[model samples]
Target: MKNPVLVALFCLMQTLILAQSPTPSKPRILISTDIGGTDPDDNQSMTHLLMNSDLFQFEGLVSSPSYGEGNKKEILRMIDIYEKDLPKLNKHNKKLAKPDFLRSICKQGRKGNAPFSGYTTATEGSDWIIKCAKKQSEHPLWILDWGGLEDIAQALHDAPEIQHKIRIYWIGGPNKKWSANSYAYIAENFPNLFFIEVNSSYYGFFSNNTEPDTINTSDYYNRVIQGGGHLGMDFKNYYDGEIKMGDSPSLFYMMDGNPEKPERESWGGSFEKITYSPRTIYNQTTTLKDTVAFCSIIEIHLKGPKIEIPSDSVCFWMEIPYGKTIQKWPGYHLGNGDYAIRYIPKKAENLHYRFTSKIAEINGLEGDIVVSNLWPGKKHSTDYPLGNHWYSDKSDINLYDEKIQGGKTVLKWRNVILDDWAKRWKWLK
Candidate 1:
């Protein structure tokens, strides 16, 4: 016979269940990316993944490179952006900027000078991917590939043990009639997997004011730091000659159709339809399959105070001449910036609340970074005490300081960052 109190507790539990109050499920993810791939959307994907690690248990992040000559250096820069930039953010603002993708946050990470700090030693990315897949006792591990299929193809070819252990969700390949120029560059097939072919080229996120290989605006930086605006060019700033795009071109997807529709499926990181093309192979047509479900960019709506990076705040700035070069490919160019962001990866099971919303929006993989103004604390509109809230143009001080003007952040351009923060009076910090 149950005690009267126990019976009462059981009744309460049943009532709660009947009311649809159930716990949420956790998503485990493995991310692979071509960081220096030149398409800016890859950067967005990295940041979104890191910001939303709470909703996903990120297994690993493999930074791969294409066979292209200019691509190698860009690859290294991508790794640095996600790996080395952590210390700088903390030093300047006393806040830790987490990884955009993820590694082992709770595990004992290796220490080094730069990108080698906190990550798995997947020297051979494909082999490493296979090894990780075969050893996973955990079920339903999600693999997100935001780059070339070379590594995955290699991993599959090498290790047949894990052919069915993972469910790959990627943003790649030309699934329709028009194939990518690199169609014949790969040679591995896995039918057990479901692909999310991303029409990344159709994405109009990257802005190109000029081809300044070194000096460029920080669209990625502003997205994580500033808030509220469109993706390509913040409409509020575009009319005044201020552009924020960096060049992920718009030939990836045909947005006329719904991404969930069948025909909408196409290539990864491009806009063109998935079709057999005679462009690359011996001047003859071929069946080039990308993924199962292909779609374009998931436009995220970010709303916050549009702050300005004042020149007077030069004390809160830092930079190096050759900022975004590659590690493996020293010749490539990921971007013009010198700094990258990094953090120790902890299982999403731990930081569930702080980053769940941001992660859920981007499918916990790669797309749109949702930055919240409420990170550690709030900041005043007139001044930033090194907290979360942004300093909008609507702030107390005039966003322009005629005394020190330069860089992409300028008042005349109606853009941010034109002011010289390293002035004699400012006394560089």
Candidate 2:
């Protein structure tokens, strides 16, 4: 006969054994974030990440405040939808199937728009992130902080230990987002950790008036507008009577399509961006310019009508997978939350280090290998593009072993990118 105390100990050991099963494998990932929360580039960044999930493990997305934006709840809602779309991702693309852990993690908590029911959760972003990150040590979590440094900062404070367990990637800060802040929270807090931050708010896409009329031309109009290749092509297909402008795939595709706004109104938003390189610091604001590091440099310029500056707009990164077809073209800001763009080079520096799945050969388009034709390999391009290059383990996109039929899943413009933010909020447009 065994003693009661000894029996309890045996049960405890058995329970622990059952609890600690096989740990999940660490996955590579590609994270899209709105580092500078309010910037439109955050939207584009999210779309890119979603369309290219094959190249990334994409553990999850974290939203906060960056670039002056105050709140990021709505943005979090949108990403949650993408997080919930995992089943569809598995259905359409045979190359993927999200792990049960990622599937479960996405729903740890979320935000609601209808004010608050008191029973509903306000925001558990920081809490959700820390817990999930610690649970998934097998897959190196690649966290893309696109908005401000709110959730992440809180996350580090909550579970400082997870920092050492996961890889971190940042996309904003330098002038406004202090490097020392990140150092204290990241480098200092979690040593021997993987981290890469790109302050794209300055280096990202923007517009200027230097170029002449482009999309308005008769030749261009006829090619895109009339030839079924124009913005009208997507517009005609999407607006097939659904004028409510509700969230739909067509809406996102036509985000830049201005059936009414003439070509004379389109524009971009920045002038130049400086990336941390092995050695260089020429194209950045003076504040924290020399503090961190520089890796790449890109030209930027903004052109568009000003709107009622309502304090600030929040931004965040995307976690879904985006493919080459989606990353095929260049874009511009149409202002008033209505974006318009083209593939042609209009701005003076339009051709400077422009990266797209098309140019990068992400999906592997046979016979179209532009690797050699790129940089010194192709047309004798520069040796370095942005500078301090870094890839994330989570950014490793792969095909799943599920029985999913259909062709390679690609980004076929969905509604998240199109709906006018101002309209959704029922505010001024």
Which of the numbered candidates is closest to the native, going by highest TM-score?
A: 1
Model 2 residue 351 lDDT? 23
Give candidate 2 regions above 4 Å deviation: 1-37, 67-123, 174-188, 200-429
The digit string of per-residue lDDT tens for model 1 on 1-429 reads: 379999999999899888886554455555565553444455544433332234454566666544222233443344455454444334443332354433332111111111211122334566657666776464555566555455555455456557567655444332211112111222113433433333222221222433434233444334333332122122223323233322111111111123223223232121222222111111111122211112111111222222343311111111112225422211111122111121111101111111112223211221112222111112222211211111111111222122111112222232212222111112111
C-alpha RMSD values across all candidates: 23.4, 20.4
Candidate 2 lDDT score at position 24: 38
Q: What is the C-alpha lDDT of each candidate?
A: 0.31, 0.31
TM-score of 2: 0.36
Worst 10 residues of 2 by lDDT: 367-376
TM-score of each: 0.38, 0.36
